[model samples]
Target: MDVRRIGVVGLGAMGAGIAQVAIEAGFDVVGREVSDELGTAATERIGHFLTRKVEKGRLAQDARDAALGRLRTTTDVSELVDCDLVVEAIVEELQAKRALFVELERFCRRDTVLATNTSALSVTEIAAATASPERVVGMHFFNPAPLMPLVEVVRGELSSDDAVATALDVVDRLGKVAVPCHDTPGFVVNRVLIPLLNDCVRVLDEARVSPEALDAAMTNGAGWPMGPCTLLDLVGIDVHVHASEALYEKLRETRMAPPPRLVAMRNAGLLGRKSGRGFHGY
Candidate 1:
């Protein structure tokens, strides 16, 4: 399917970034938020992002304006009825996502591709809630979606080949590298990355080394751009805990389990950069 118009639900950090990406990629994008205030905030956030790109000489002012012109924001879910592809980037809870997809299936065309940007939830479970499970797929974009080059095109057990192909095509049009993976917890990147982050948490809990030292070891020794603690902060400690818990529940592996310190941090409302504290202060 030729996806000319895209709908992005939940205009949070990831959703706004995804919407910006689609707009810059020359797609007419309708971004949905739960309220008018949030919709406005998302729009402003996208504008700031584009303006920064222009300031950095990465994007021309005219190009930025054109991309902004093609984008619209709405509080109504019905605004997405005309979108060729609708990607849900809402809360990571299963029931909430399933509810949104079920509602989308009610209004969208039979062939309209419905995608979930869930990092750890079961795509199959979400798809099962819709009338046409074959049309549902997972399009897991990394954090800071506009800048991330990798997009995992996940195929649920019931996802149609055509759906997967269409998703991959959309990813290609956005100038991203698309890797196909099955509907497994964490898909691929988080499946491996989260475990490593958990291990880093364990090391810290054991008081083996300081966060700075551990991060330095990874960045200087392993040549990684950022260390685990830095990445965890960026990814949100609560998000890491949630993803780790989900993986552990499914895989029954200690490596996938979230460390006690991580859970404690989350319970204490120290949810990383967004919350101002996590493994380390923001």
Candidate 2:
């Protein structure tokens, strides 16, 4: 389970953090994006994130330099041919991810582990599209990947025990807690957390309480770090919508369905912090 070169196929927030964590864990990372500009920006953002860590005395300057030195950026997915592991953190689109895995199979070696950072989607479906289904697994890192300690090592229907072991080894190398799970919708954390957040939104919609008051009750009364609405805004309304849909479809439970206000908010483009508005202002 010696991981050397790692490839991250997506430059979004989760991808950037995963790349940072990998680089810091002594793995040479190649970050691939759809465009050159995005690749460069993702690289710069990683540098900035590491710089902040150094400023906070959490990471040494020499270590930061070494980590940065290990990072490579490219717009060509084929450049990841030599990578030992490639993790896809792209948008939660089944067709898009399936297409990418098929393409990756053509370029990468037979033994290369193909993992998806999908929070909610069928790992079995994703693996079905790849030539090496046994080697395809889910390495779901939580939001703010560098900061979160939990990593869900999901075993799809066709994912081999070796693949799960390899993913767990990588999780240990990254200094995160690895929780092995089947290809269950929402896995473990989001399966419970998303519904709670949705319930919070329902509470607001039902006139049970105001968003501010509800948030305060959770934080102050329940001793939560942040209110549900605040966390929802940070998680992005669109992300919640996708996760809710996945859960509802799998469990066939109304409680897991996305609240009306959330769907309306997303339809109106009020996608929380990313869109400068949600339950709260950006």
Candidate 3:
């Protein structure tokens, strides 16, 4: 399939980064936000990110200009109709996503592929809402999508081989490593990642050591770039809880159970970097 135009149906950090990546890859990108205010914020954020790349000599001036030129921002969902692919990166709600999929089906062309950026939601369940389930795949890009190297090309029960091939090709075009996985709970990265972070929470709950010391042990001993608590703070406690609960409920594993510390942090409204507080205060 010819993928000349791309639609990003959200302008959050991840969505904006995906838009930037698409634009940089020479595709005409339409980034949709629910409101004009948020759209403007996203546009400025992308502009700043690209400008930084230019300043760091990572992106050429003319190339950055050309990429930005290819980007269009809109509040209308109808603008996505001509796009060859539409990636929905909106809120992580099943009902909301299903409704959007139903609405998108009405506007998207027959051959246009619809994908979700959902991190933990059941891709099969999301795909079932569309008339063409085979066309719906999970194109799960990591957070800060432009910088992240890994992109999980998830295949739902109803997803087609052609769809998976197309998604992998797109991932390659975006300069990302593509790892295809069955649409299982938490997919691959989150399945292995979140539980370990929960273990860190459990360790802290024992009060045997300070968060600072635990973080140092992991980073120094394990050679991790960032320790579990630090990473969780960066990802947000609320997001961790959501992913953890989703995985635990689906897998029925005690290891996936979110520790009490995570619940305590959430109750305290220490969401993480977004809220400026978490396991470690921002």
TM-score of each: 0.97, 0.97, 0.97
Model 3 pairs in collision:
none
lDDT of each: 0.93, 0.93, 0.90
The alpha-carbon root-mean-square deviation between model 3 and the true structure, to one decimal in Å, is 1.2
The lDDT, on a scale of 0 to 1, for candidate 1 is 0.93
Ranked by lDDT, the better of candidates 2 and 3 is 2
Which 10 successive residues of model 2 have the least lDDT summed?
Answer: 203-212
TM-score, cand. 3 vs. native = 0.97
What tens digits encode model 1's per-residue C-alpha lDDT throughout 136-222? 999999999988899999999999999999999999999999999999888999888989888888888587888889999899999
- State the lDDT of candidate 3 residue by residue for 1-25, as single tens digits: 7789999998998899899899989
Rate residue 131 of model 2 by lDDT: 71
Q: What is the lDDT of residue 194 in candidate 1?
A: 85
Q: How accurate is candidate 2 locally (lDDT)?
A: 0.93
Tell me the spans in candidate 3 whose CA falls farther than 4 Å from its real position.
none
